[model samples]
Target chain A: MGLVANAGDSRAAVVDRPGAVAVAAVLGYLVLDLVVKLSGISVFFLGMQVLGGSLELGSLLSMVIDGLLVGLAVGLAGIGLSMTYSILDFANFAHGDTVTAGAFLGWVAAYIAAGLGTGAPIAELFMLNSGRQLSTVSTFVPVLLGLVVAGVGSVGVTLLVDRLTYRPMRAAGNISLLIASIGVALAMRYLIAFVFGTQTSGVASGGLRITFFGTVSMTDNEVTLLVVSLLLMLAVHLLLQRTKLGKAMRAMADNEDLARVTGIPTERVIRLTWILGGGLAGVGGYLLVLESGTISFNFGWILLLLIFAAVIVGGIGSIYGAMAGGVLIGLVDSLALIWLPSGLTRAAAFLVLIVVLLLRPSGIFGGVTTA
Target chain B: MSQRATVSAEVTLPDPSERLLAIRNLDAGYGDLQVLSDVHMDVADEEYVVIVGPNGAGKSTVMKSVFGLTTYMGGEVVFDGTDISERNPDEIIYEGISYVPQTGNVFGSLSVRENLEMGAYILDEVPEDRIEDVYERFPILRERSEQDAGTLSGGQQQMLAMGRALMLDPDLLLLDEPSAGLAPDLVEDMFDRIDRINDDGTAILMVEQNAKEALRRCDRGYVLVQGQNRYEDDGSVLLNDEQVRQDFLGG
Candidate 1:
């Protein structure tokens, strides 16, 4: 809170003339810093490499790719969070658990589908203990089936949760709803732990790797994540732009009172919002597991903060902003390894978030609402 | 036209069969705080009625009460013979009435056509012809159909808000302060458009802060002071009455 006050105070002081000058100076310094570091040129008087001896070209490229891979997942997950915040007007803490729920439900379905008639008991398959190696190439059908189940199952979970919790508290203030969501989040996280056990386990195998033009290389899972995320993102874009329900959602977000006066069924819109947000969170979680080749009971719970950082950075209520913010935070988190240790990368991503808030306040698309 | 200079105490209401909207001794307010009392008024079929008064006169509240936005403390709001005093806004909309609020009337983030599309959301399908009709009435909106409503000028936004309300083609249209923030030049243009809409057979129940101009144009005018009806008369009679001039029109 004090940090926010100080940032706001400094912004007020630099309100008119010197603000532009200060911004330009800071931008100029950063550009120079980037040029010096990327070229690997050492400023001799300072000793040591300029910015820790310019990174190896291949390593830097790989770090960027890794950042994008993580960022895409974060962005995909953040979309649901952003949509709910815009329309429902609350930060749903249970969203992270919804992601976890999607992964568990999806993986179980995938296992059951893949191991059918393979002499494995249904109980073992349900427990995902068939001991079969799953990959994009080896079990393509199962992986695809898992993605669908993740989305659909998550939608069901969110709708049920909304009916049980949020729907009843619909008339409450934002702060009260927010607190209720925290309680929901805790219950969901532990319920998943109890059901799936608390251990992290390997869930996928490296199926294939494609080297593009003898230079860039990517795993088959990474390719799958990229393609699926892009397609889903595109689908969301079309839905918002081309569909009636999508327009009604945006209109309701813009003005709920006017929407009601115009005869829009606001309750129905709210239900659809949960469905969309929950489905996206679930699909994103499954994709994250597919790319990383592992799954844990609380992976989504832990990833929630990073997803939040991405959403806040992008502009909390804007879907496109969440995507852009996710990629930025992802790149920064991975690229921070060039200067800071891997353990501090999360802190670096938060630092970027703070800087963005200080500068733009409303975020990249602030005041623009949910477009 | 024969009922000229009728004071609030002896105001004569139209026959129930001829009335499109009839509010009888309606009392309403927001959540426990009453703002209106015994407010009786009527808008017959295709009639243009305006309610004008000073700040806090509950002029807007009366419009809100008619549309089921305010708390129904007592009395009844009958529209085309349906008792909608306790109905919700969604239910009231289906009763052939549409309301445009004084502020935040248009969906700022939505495109022009999208805003119009949302106005017709109660219908299962988008009425493309209604969109065409709204566009015809306000050609500027058609030119900027793809643009966000937020980017429009104040006058254009007012037109869009009215256009959105017109999407349902309701028999009674409630407009709350249509010329509230418009430029002096554009105010007359807005009033002219309202005249054409009324001419095309949509009865208008409007509340306006510009009392004199509203009285000058509407077929009938009601002067509401402190939430109660003070005077009800033909527009010109209210415009010329000495008592109304002194108390409201600034003699």
Candidate 2:
């Protein structure tokens, strides 16, 4: 009994100690410094290197830009995922596949429009591999039109999925819904593979490079990705903060039963939630492929793991947390290439996620609900 | 319970034409699990009715069934003369009734004002006058209008929940256990607020755990047991009844 008492008292003391937190922070900083040292850049402090100087200045800037591009897409996509989780009460496994569907269809639309009158086989153009050079700069109208189609297409698909699968099981437990989502995920993935084929293919080409901060230069597609991501994020923010539907969504997320009795049209709000989430997922998918100039049947599936890490790190069910977490994960993963193997950057992102969780289990945004 | 046979519970029953809500032979539950049997109850326009009983007596179930939250196994729930028995909550909102659950009654993440805005979500525009009225009713909520509902004290949250329900200015309000988690001193204050709302002409159908106070305050009182109505009468009659006083009011 005395031993238990001593341990509990010390445990409380340790938890309350500010110095322990400081030590953890310092250790994290030192580890980051060590990782930076493993890279090639050079910097010195007191005749020894203890800070960043691993990559070329231009290379560093370019990586930052790349990270931001990836981050914005992930953040935008994660918003829909987070909203559904908060309101619908489950992690939608099909969300990643929803991304894939949007990208594949958006590319198909763009290819058909751009390759029209080029004498390419209509079959190849329709399948999105006619090789007709489809960069945003050269084919602005088709690309822009494709982006809109992506958003609308995903909403239609998501609503259909909800009506068919999730809606009937609304009264079911979260685990049951989660399992259903996993089934939805596998089916959607296989369906996309069946249509688009398994081979990874290139889409956009020859981007127009523009200067950033007088040091780093960004391609036209990158600029498009950044602008579109920023605008979408802003729009989502405005809709959630200023609109009645957004408040209803938040209210439902907070307490579905209470929302019901409070005269909120809960089913209608649920529909709105899917539309917003599905549209964002679709737009995010399109922007991601545009930024990388590459598309594959299962690319979105693979990207889901990293996106989960970001959402978990930021705090699941928090819209702002998902966005902020996406940026953080993207920055860390991209920047870690200095100290980590290119392939191991994803691992490093997960490690950061684990560390964040160890410190705050509810996540940085968990308690904040849908806000 | 031995005095159950001698109880005179029909005193001061309202006329059918004057009632705001009428539940006839209500048999409802969650999913396929029935929690309420054939139960008949009514709330007249501008009347204050309180249902009090022991825990798990299906008091809250009655409120849930009235709001169309639970599964309607059978029976009818007509509100303000509309047959709303099979209507879902989305359709029920148009019937001009509001419910406040015991827990999670407020949208924790939304601000007090936002919570009120959400109450009128079915409306095209936010009713500024209704919001102002809520603020006037709960002045502390007015001071904390920008604060998140989750951050509020239990009593404040209760006030905000009631205020949100009042945003629609409904003909009837179904409040479940409004004083459940309140501090002891604040319980009477919460009751005062409900009285004021009733005094303003909104018929209130409330379920409460504090039987004595609920009976003392309301115009009518109901005692339910195991999903069935046990007693129904004027509040004072129930308060003075020997069986009710001993079995429910903890004599």
Candidate 3:
């Protein structure tokens, strides 16, 4: 009997270490995530809902899934953010405005497609109408069209920004660059508001909801968003880790002079970096609109702090760090209402960012610093 | 002192020669500031040619001008019969002129193998056989192929820089002060490796501050003063000249 008890106790001890580790990881993630949500001012509605005792297993799962999607979206945004840091070596203050511009373009393209009457080759393929019925495959069509429009808009804005603002500022160095970028940001904000009008717009059509596990229901838009974000993040990861162009980008970030000496066309690489970074921001804007069903001229600007916090927490110029940081920030922002007021969630992210900056200035992942 | 004599003896050996590289009246410098003024030099295809001088003698500027890093005010830089003065650095590299700067020379964040791959960036195609050949020459690099270049020792980093430049199988290699901050023993080993590099058929045009040692290893030597070539002679003749030895070599 003693032998049997001893064997059981030994087995229990063996299992306890892994269990403790898993629990610790989850709890740590929860606390960090809560801080981000509070910092972002998103915990108000969440607080009310939780206080009303309306949080059920199904609701919790749905919230978790929503948080996951947001995290993935932010991670995708992180790739673009990392690239921006590489090219300019400073936060492109106008980046959020560029995202809004892409969103506006996506909206315009969808509106134009809707007006051309369904079934015309271009109209039928690209249009998103409120009353239109979509088949399983057709559900994917609007998102793709949105992505294409956003990508083009992003590349155009990026080029323009480089020509008008970044190029001159780069020659002048850091402080002048910062001022110019801020000027571009403010100018872009007003420009987007003027063109798109000062009203909110929705990108998703009312569609059939797919129910899973007899309790979880998701719309076509949400599923589209989640899948698209995942695929894009995967593609970006592969591009940065596996390709020659990616290696060149890393090298430039490490040592620009050495990269130039090694035959890397520095100007071309800079252009490519802008296009890619701006394009990702554009996609993030479009995804946010699809998920929330509403977007305004200030959509990206409002999210700027959260995004900045994510990038900073992850470490500047580190793609993997950005992704991890984005997801972590997103989860916290989405779930903070569980324990705190909604208005304070966003600020929590900033607090965490401050702590990270103070403690580990190199960030969670050690970033490559150029001499 | 006896050990120094033996190392100097080890450096005096010579090999067969062919035309490696030639530069004529290479006037080049940064914007508005002339660093090299009408300097002329040559290295037989398989010869080691070292340019030695004081700190401000423009030795590095000479290498930079040849590699197209600096603008040439006038004169021709011919490498393998191609006039490269008008070409960009990458184009010059394609024309078989490889340059390794004095400091921060390697891409620090890249692995040893990646640095080597980047060395051959100008080539339309990279032959795997050449990589294996370089590995055979620097076995230490092979052991640390996956390690970052920045973590390597100064001497090891210099070797990696040279190995990277050789990846394109260039006919001529330009080195700027390879022994800049090495220990005495490491400097000796570095000179020996340079001699081996020359023996393997790449002509070397190097700027070194260690004048006596540089003069001991090279077939010919040039002394530059204030961006102009002041003296040129056979290595042994310069080593034996009283004035050359006193003024430059600190003998």
Candidate 4:
């Protein structure tokens, strides 16, 4: 009975304070183990091999690169999620489906543009598995057009959704709005599935591979994703830092009541928030497809958990926090492959999120808000 | 002060035609919770008016009602001969009035410059001259132009809030408890700044918890008790009245 009580107390303590010593021990062990494995150094305790595995330095480098690319996509999408959460004061569950919508809209445009002169039927192009090859190098114009369309089209969809569903309930409590968003998510998901069949398919042909430092290799699509995501991130930074509308957004996020009294058109700001966020999610979704060379109806929905994990870990309302959290979650998701199977990498990411929340409930950028 | 008091006794208020703002039979409050009932008040052009009251007396509610931040049950808020009781705050701002809330008035996470810029968000371009004027009035804000408002001391934050409201260069400015959270030393300095602003000819409507000090400084004062008007007189008369001093002022 005494032993049972002690176990229960420790369990309760983990929920309250979270055993810092235990967390540190686990983290230290993981680090030490990773280092040992990377260095190919074995540890022997009492004539028994306790730690070490053959992890190549090259493989680790590739993991980091892979993690960075995926992180950029997740981070880009997270910017919109974080903005809406901050400005709208609700967790929009439909955000993931918005991404899916962007991907489909952009991919359709790309396919139709690329197969324009080809004798292929319009339906085959719409199906996105046309016999004609398409890649960044082969179909640059089509890809560019697709990216633009993705952003603009998503903006339209978000605005319409807000007008039809959210605006009427603007004064409602956060829970009502959140639950309403969940319903929106379901409606959008099924609508997309109905319009574009549910089956996933490879859409892009592999482009040129660029080698970096004579050691690391990256695909042309990956490089494109890198440049575009970085440029868009910079644009976002400028918008938030230098523009009047952006400052109003930050101010509204800081204190809505004050914003209203200060004579800011709250409705206009809300519309702009959706426009900016929807645009980012749209572009981010298109770029993810560009990198992965595949398109699906539900990829965005599947990616939603990871996006949310990033947002919460970084701090819900902070843009920079979302970016940082996205990269961290992405790196952890990829790097965890070293120990766990690829299927379980998502689980590893969530474990890290749980640990992070237990350590700092507000997240890494909690107090700083939208700025 | 004595000579001014003698002149105020035979007071010739600016004609009602020149009144900048008039609140008649005002009834307003948060949804389902009435706070202000049949409240009547007025501010003449360039007039400096202050509202003083005990806690929960609806002084702030009156200010908010004028700004259209509260639900209007029945009232007429006329500004410059235009009925504006039905207008929203955004529209009211265009009518040449600006409001500075008692607290959370400044955008804490934004830079001082950004906070000031947000104040003029309704304008097509950033008015550099008005920004300069605000900086000239509050030199500390100029030095901390790029710093976030949240990092400032309470006194500095209050100054920033005032500067933000001044960005639009409104004809009438409503300030709610500008001295509420200031250190005792800073309160006098804050009141002096308001006096200077009013002296420059902008009509001032303020609600202050610092009754004695507010009454001493305003041209006219209104004593609101439990959401109803209790007294209206020249600041000097209210300050000297035995009943007013005993009940509202901590004599």
Candidate 5:
């Protein structure tokens, strides 16, 4: 009884744990030291890597700019994945392929528009098999048309997929739906490979580059991607926050049965969910290839893991969280190149995801299903 | 004008014998588990009906079956001369029936205004006058129109749920446990608001746990036990019935 009384509060043992204290001390010390170094006047450390390394104010700002551009693309792609998870109550493994579908569809349309009757065979143009530079400069009209076709084509593909596959198996539960999505993903990947072939090809032709600050030039490709992605994201935000359809989406996410009972037309809402999710995913794919200058059948499948990482870290079902999480993932993936090998940067970002999930299992914006 | 006439001409006034909602020999359940058996009930035009019973007596299931939310095994649900027994909820909405579930009736993440907007989803445009009437009916909601429904107090959320259902100005409104989580003082206010809605000519079919209070306000009442009808009488008659008072109302 005396020993029991001497135990103090129930948390006494945990508080006295030496390992926890050491980790906390190290993390705290690192943060404080970094803060001191950034102040630049302190000069507390002997080495340059500890004090500054190659990260100058100019370079850091440039790095932030670079990170943000790619981050916006990641965020834009993550929105559709987040929407599907929240509204449909399942993770669509095929979403990445949907992005690829949009990108390829848009590219084909661009190729046909630019190369039609200009000494290039229609077959080669449609297949995108030839080595052609279809850039913003050489194919402005076709590129803009491609963007439109990207949005339209993906919408068509998604709606068809929903009608053929998802709609029928909706009541089969999330696990079955998830497994079904994996099948869809494989089918889509191989189909694209079948059509476009397994070869990696360059799509966009490079245009002008404008220097922003010294040595930090904004390529036309980056600017175009940035502007288009940001505008779409803004449109999505406005649609969700200020429109009737958006509210219905949110309501369905909250409770499908209540939504139906309240005359919200739950089935119609589900259809709309697929439409928007598929549409955004298509645009995301189109933008990814436009920015990266390369297109492959499996590019989207490869990028799916990173996009999923962003969605999970941002809070699985939250659109805004997806965007923020995407940017954070992008930045981490970019900035990790400073400390680790370029090949290991993706691994670092994923490790960060594991750590964050350990600390906040619900994620940065979880528990709020405002789709 | 011709198109409008053509659209409106299809509908005619219903016969007087046809009640707003008529449930006969309803057998419903979730999956294979039968929760209600041979449930029979009726609500006339503008009539207020209340179903009261003990826990797991399938009081809510009866309401759910009427709304086509439960699996129908047998019998039929006839609403406004239409055998809506086989109809789904989306089709039933066009029949002018709105149901508010006990829990999760309102979208917690959506703002009060957005939740209300979602209620009028079938309409092409926002009905401003109806929104104003709803605001007048519950002024507290107007004050917190932009606030998230989740952030509201229990009483406010209950009001918002009722308001959302009322957005359609439904012919028949199904309410399950309207006063379940309310503050003691707010229960009467909720009842009074329901009375106002009923007075405005909207038929109400409610399932409540508070038998005595529910009986006091409703026009007619049904006592259900073990998924079967125990008694059916005028609210005052059941309140006064010695058997009902001792068994269900705990007098």
Candidate 6:
């Protein structure tokens, strides 16, 4: 008992060092935040101070805290997302689209439910019923419904891609597999555009806001997105770590031929992998739409670079990397807008990706090394 | 070699009995390359049959063809009264024949117990005591029940492969090079286990490179050269035969 306590103390001390470092980092960010705020170069500074920083500790701390939180989130998301790619050995280019689709579905469902109560037509409720307010229960109902709908969509697309593209190109080798994935990406892009149109559509209806610590305030939409993403991530984490199916999935990913000869039913395991991967992608898309308050054909496509950057930076096959990568990218993109031009923030995420790849090609977490 | 053969010709032939597995006029190969031709052999019930040949003499090919892993152009493999020449490997396994391949035969990533469980994957009900019985035979396996098969030594892996085959409770077990790459002691122990398996009522059709040792422990044996059956006799007769010893038995 004493030894365990000592070990726990050491671990806690290690954790505290990072926390202290984060505090120092945030303080440094606050200083930068103040310079931007005082210069008044852009009206965006007002929003930054309002949305991004703390007053007493300065903008440096705020920025650092922001970076750290974003890093942690990206790492977590990256870990979750990479499990799919690492296990399946397939790059799901349509994953971002799946997330957007889920968010869009949630938005549509919420709008419809709001509309039904107001006795408006379905089209008007979805398109222009901006005044209808939903109860908390009603607000969450769409999220659940959206998740299921998006999950189904993700699975369908994954199966379709497997049957139509992956299975055939697998024999053709890696280059062909890559080309097929590109083809799938293009098809998904055009299909989404054809169905949803190429314009940004507002999904969030009310100006719901909540304040935390007198400085950090979040909208209901943002809060929902964060909470749902975290919950989904947790569920996936448990699924991968605890279940028999999850063990089978990991075993299959580690060595497929071994799994097959061991009578693991490779086909079933493959199908389940696709389902889980697609479903997670769907949830990610839904969160994207909710947080952004808009959906367009190119939205997911535009976000693909950021998502890939997150997945790669965290680790190719490591699930923890995906989660960490997502939040890190989000926070970096958010904070990079403080210094660089808006157009350059997206490029900054990619830049981080390239630099990380150069430094550690296997990612922050190690990927499977092919002998 | 000729003088050695001439010195030991006074061996009598033993009568053949009820056939457990019979291969006739077998012509099998991989993609236009004829490896085995007109191969004829039979294993009787409760008998241990060993095939001895030099490397690349199509010994493994014979085992593979019987296990339905190789493509055969012309052949009939009757196992326990069923014609199984065209059957799939899994079907052959289900028809009471278990095959242990020469390389990568067991699941390396799985625990020893899991590998054994997989052996009985085709069966709806694998008796719990079968695992205990196998453990009793291989106490080392029981000690490392949860250890991955990859972590085991070569001899232990061979034992695990044999034990896995026994899990299915198959009537016939096909082993390809059971004694290959083993320490001399392990080889002798493996031969003894083969004898014990035969004693336990499972017909073993093994392809071995250890000609003298394998033949000495088997009930019957076959000598193959260039994929054709060159000689067939009781194990003891073949072990002492002058011509057989000179031509193929490494005399």
Taking chain B only, the TM-score of every model is 0.96, 0.93, 0.89, 0.93, 0.92, 0.91
Worst 10 contiguous positions by lDDT, candidate 3 chain A:
A127-136
Chain A TM per candidate, in order of listing = 0.90, 0.89, 0.78, 0.92, 0.87, 0.75
Cα deviation of B70 in candidate 5 (Å)?
1.1
Alpha carbon lDDT at A128, candidate 6:
27
Q: Which ten residues in a row are the worst by lDDT in model 2 chain B?
A: B1-10
Query: Which docking band does candidate 1 fall into?
Result: medium
**In DockQ, how does model 3 score against the reference complex?**
0.36
Q: Model 1: residues >4 Å from true position, as ranges?
A: A1-41, A129-133, B1-12
Q: Against the correct fold, how does model 4 do in TM-score?
A: 0.93
Ranking by lDDT: 4, 1, 2, 5, 3, 6
Residue-level lDDT of model 6, residues A31-108, one tens digit each, is 555665655533345446332332343453455554544444344334434665766676666565555554555556
| Model 4 Cα interface RMS deviation (Å) | 1.2
Candidate 1 residue-wise lDDT at A43: 70
Instruction: Residues A79-175, candidate 4: write the lDDT tens digits.
Output: 8899889999999999998988998899899989999888889999988877555678878999999999999999998999999999999989989
RMSD of 6: 8.3
Q: After the best TM-score superposition of candidate 2, give how far the Cα of residue A242 lies from its true spot, in angstroms.
A: 0.9
> Model 2, residue A315: what's the lDDT?
88
Best by DockQ: 1
- Candidate 2 residue spans exceeding 4 A from truth: A1-53, B1-15
TM-score of chain A of 1: 0.90
For each candidate, give its TM-score against the true structure. Answer: 0.93, 0.90, 0.81, 0.93, 0.89, 0.71
Q: Candidate 6 clash total?
A: 39
True contacts kept of 4: 0.81
Off by over 4 Å in 6: A1-114, A119-138, A165-175, A204-264, A291-294, A298-371, B1-18, B31-34, B123-127, B180-185, B193-195, B241-250
Reference-based lDDT, residue A105, model 4: 91
Off by over 4 Å in 4: A1-24, A46-49, A131-133, B1-16
Q: Give one digit per residue, the lDDT tens place, for model 6 in B82-127.
A: 8888886756777788877777766565578866776776556555
The i-RMS of every model, in angstroms, reads: 1.2, 1.6, 2.7, 1.2, 1.6, 5.0
Q: Chain A of candidate 3 scores what in TM-score?
A: 0.78
DockQ preference between candidates 1 and 5, better one: 1
